[model samples]
Target chain A: MSEVKDTQGQLWEVFIQTKKGLPFKHFGSVHAYDKEMAIQNARDLYTRRGEGRGMWVVPADAIVAIDSSDDESFFDPSNDKVYRHPTFYELPDGLKNM
Target chain B: MDNLNLSKFCIRLGDHCLIMAHRQSELCSNGPFLEEDIAQINLGLDLLGQAEALLIYAAKLEGGTRTADDLAFRRPERQFHNFMLTEQPNTDFAFVIVRQYIMSLYLLKTYQALSKVEDDTLSGIALKALKELTYHERHFAMWLKRLGDGTEESHERTQTAINELWMFVGELYEEDEIDFMAQKASYAPTGIEMKTFLMEHITAKFSEATLETPHSIYMTTGSKKGIHTEYLGYLLTEMQYLQRAYPDAKW
Candidate 1:
């Protein structure tokens, strides 16, 4: 009856909410054969009291991870380019809300 | 039974939380890693919080000078009524998972039933606790499935845990006259059967996990009456040491 073993389950990410009016932030990952199983696992892993409103379980392989080595050239130059900081320029009080 | 009798009943519920919280507390700084360690510790805190609220209610019902602390620290092992399931030593991750899985299911059912209690305080406590326990159930249930379906080693260990612990599930439903009294008093639901619900949920969970269900007829008893397995005494000793040693030492 063990058609698909536990080991064959795929990894899926989870998100959760701690209470009402909360967002379902990324919580953790669980392994399951399909989306339905993944959602169930996510419910077990993420929601307890109804702690989670919703969750999205993407296969572990589907995520394109950014390489750590590209940290310098990828974004370091932006630090010296102060123009990117919107806070650097003071806007008049008329545009304060904007 | 009168409210005095009901106090004893509430204490039994408190004892369940206190003992389990005490067991979970040992995990502080001893979790597998930072996140897991924090999670277990948080779980311990939550269980203790639940115990505190229930015991305080019990103290009020008794119409005596005793407080929650008295019940928590001064009570003997034989006086503390909790299920044997919560009292079992967390021998490994497998045991921990099994304990959480079983307790979560029980708490979910218990709190849901208790939410409609006539007592405003009891209903409030149940309402708050119900939210927390829902998460507890989900967390352990997910892990049970993962570990059951994970590596061969993990699967084997978890299956062993399930088989070993299966006998204790019976205690969750073993109600007596006291429970019936509580039901009649509107302290809890009347004829609320937990066995069928528990069995169905666990059976489905095990099936999904591909874990073999144990067939042992040796169901442990006496937890409802405050009698316990051998492990409870040692657990109570450590748990009560502070209060026992320094009587009235509290904030």
Candidate 2:
């Protein structure tokens, strides 16, 4: 069982968008007891300029990020895969929404 | 009951915001961490922005030559009508949060009440400010719960902060001539209505935080009538120093 009680003061990863139709970007983290409070606290702390239409607060522990120490091995193969690029495809004349 | 009264009312409103903003601004560099420091300053800026808006309206109401800077800087400490809660020193993160938590709860209701004022200016101010206070209330409500229930040390510290600040809170809802004048002018909520609403609201949050409410004791009242704790003088000195030192000097 994931115990919230034992994980007090744990970090939360906050993502926010400055407005609707804007991409969510990393803003900041706050130490909170739960997801709801974390998001509210993030809104209070971050979106003062009407800078966000929405926010996402995920507990840092819940994020399974790839280890940065293994960055070269884990990400290098994908980086060199130019064949994965959409540039390989010729665009039609009216291919407006790339 | 004329524009003069309206001006005074708005100045009082601005004073509340400016004093609280200055106090919160003091937290920017000194928060427990970078994130909280940013959050505290965000609130501080919100309050200062609100003060500017209200003070401008107050100046117009007075039909005075003075600007917001004049009122904010030229007045002596005795003339400021802000609550002592806003003027108190930021003792610690817990202390600041507790004070804000309680004040947010009260201010949420205060603005809601103000929204019904007959004065268009007051109504507009209240409506817009209500939106800001909604988030403020939510943010601190969460902190109050987290700190209260997080750990033994956090709980005890938050509880102590709440108890110490409880005395200052009563002044927020304490009605006097100003409130009565507001009511008479159809520009304020009745004290009875505001009190009942705020108490029930605060009680629910306290219950959720799993903390016992401080017994209603030593709840001082009088800030609205210009009486304040000793701390107000020092805060005014800091806030008004620049303006006082160089009167009429423009940026």
Candidate 3:
């Protein structure tokens, strides 16, 4: 079948924070015409099960992603950089979060 | 504190939620999009939850062998006390949104008043349902503005819906004997208060939406006395079909 035009308005990505002090993780996406509609749609779609205490909606097109073809060049070099690893430095016994 | 009237009052509240929930549920798979479909169903679920709570309380007030399920499934058309607006058909998305906007406005005010009533159970139920109705009112109001100002076709259709459903808006605050009894016992807001609030909010919201409020002087009434539009009978038939077919059916 030929591709049909989508008239359901713009796409939005949803983020949900399950608690007040927690970070908002990427939840899902919904189609809405504007920011207000996007937020409401996200609330209805992603938070219906009480899974979220806070929500954020961003335009799907607003996100910038790296090209998959550059994955090896961009990411593989970091894998062998042993000195950059946090475990490479031994922490003193009294050290805290470090 | 007449138990009979108070019980009847609870039934009226429960019936409104039940009928409206059923109307929302009818559009389960028929929403314009997947997100919208789920949203509408979620609205239905919220209303159904409120209905069950109100009906259960109504049954308790009656002090009978009746369960909430029995009150919901066994009641006949003439016995239901839902507002006529709640039973209107979802002709289109515009109609559904308009109907929901009107009902939500009414319910929000009603629940706000009920939350402070003398009765503890009713007040508790109203407080919880008030939170849900707040979102419901805002959601529908947003849709109303969107449809009213979005496009020419949408604007025209939404205007048509507002005009069509405007006739039933008056019945929401129509003062009847039951209403008087509830108001007397501190169980509900006065009819005048409800009417004034509804008129002011509706006028302001309509202006914001760039929609015209109908100038018609004729308003339909009579849901309080169980007199409803013909559409309700058909709706109840479908809703009660399973229970009527198998009297002992269980979930």
Candidate 4:
């Protein structure tokens, strides 16, 4: 019964999965008065051309993001960590599906 | 009935979708919001696709040089046989949703029955149309509920639309002479059964939306018999303008 409308509409971010077992990718957002209409809007907007097999809608306000403007405080610590990269290690020769 | 009769009936069916598409396109870039605009366009596109296939089949059945384009653009207002409900003016968003909701529900029942007809081509068309119709019915249904239960003005506007358009609902269920013949040949379903299903679904949806239903039992008919409202003339004037002004025009 998630619903949105013109009067009390809330913005919902849309995620679409093109196939089963695939990750849902963020497409965009739509304002809807109810959950049903939100999903309908997503289907019409995001999947009209059979672009996706599944969809997830969450209120825009539900998402929390790290403050990107202050990049050095958090994300920068991992930006140049070459040891964390798989390419940094040499794989044993001929390791299939590794 | 003869092939001519069957074709005539097919024209009526095609006209419903074509006219509805024509009317809804009037809302292009005029929707309440961007998402709404996109939704309306998708709905119109679906109607347009269905119209093209049905009219193509109709033109072929007529066994003449006439094409779907000819039937769509060249026919005078009197020759076009679309439901009065579909040819209605888009007075407001509420009206558009209500009128569309009614037609979509009607289509859902009729198309489902039509998909099983003895004629493979027509049945295939019905199957394709039903998939499109499924989304259409839901789109309008969702809007109808939102408008009917939203604001006082919205509720009032929607109720007025339903009251104004309810009288025409009878015509969708009426089996005309050609329709009866099509039913006998298993090319189409009986309108009465579809009407019953439509009414039940409409009633349930109305209650959920908190919308009022018109009590008027008086019915209006004539579109199927080549008679139409004054609105149709104006609509045709705009829709056929490009083709009429420039014969053999192409995109």
TM-score of each candidate structure, all chains considered together: 0.76, 0.83, 0.94, 0.92
What lDDT does candidate 2 reach at residue B5?
78
For every model in order, the fraction of real contacts preserved is 0.00, 0.50, 0.93, 0.79
Q: Write the per-residue lDDT of candidate 4 for residues B67-124, one digit (tens) a residue.
A: 9999999999989999999999999998899999999987887787789887888899
- The most accurate candidate by DockQ is 3
lDDT of 3 by residue, A1-98 (tens): 45998889998999998998888899989999899889988988888788988889999999988999999988888867677878867778997544
lDDT of 4 at B108: 80
lDDT of 1 by residue, B75-119 (tens): 898888898888898888888988888888888887887798777
| Residue clash pairs of candidate 4 | A2-A35, A3-A33, A3-A34, A3-A35, A4-A32, A4-A33, A4-A34, A5-A32, A5-A33
Residue B164's lDDT in candidate 1: 77
Q: Rank the candidates by DockQ, best first.
A: 3, 4, 2, 1
Across all models, the iRMS values in order are 6.6, 3.2, 0.6, 2.0
Alpha carbon deviation, residue A32, candidate 1 (Å): 14
Which regions of candidate 1 deviate over 4 angstroms?
A1-98, B189-192
Chain A TM-score per candidate? 0.67, 0.71, 0.80, 0.76
- DockQ per model, Cα: 0.10, 0.38, 0.84, 0.57
Candidate 3 backbone overlaps, count? 0
**Model 2 interface Cα RMSD in Å:** 3.2
The C-alpha RMSD in Å for every predicted model, in order, reads 6.5, 4.3, 2.4, 3.8
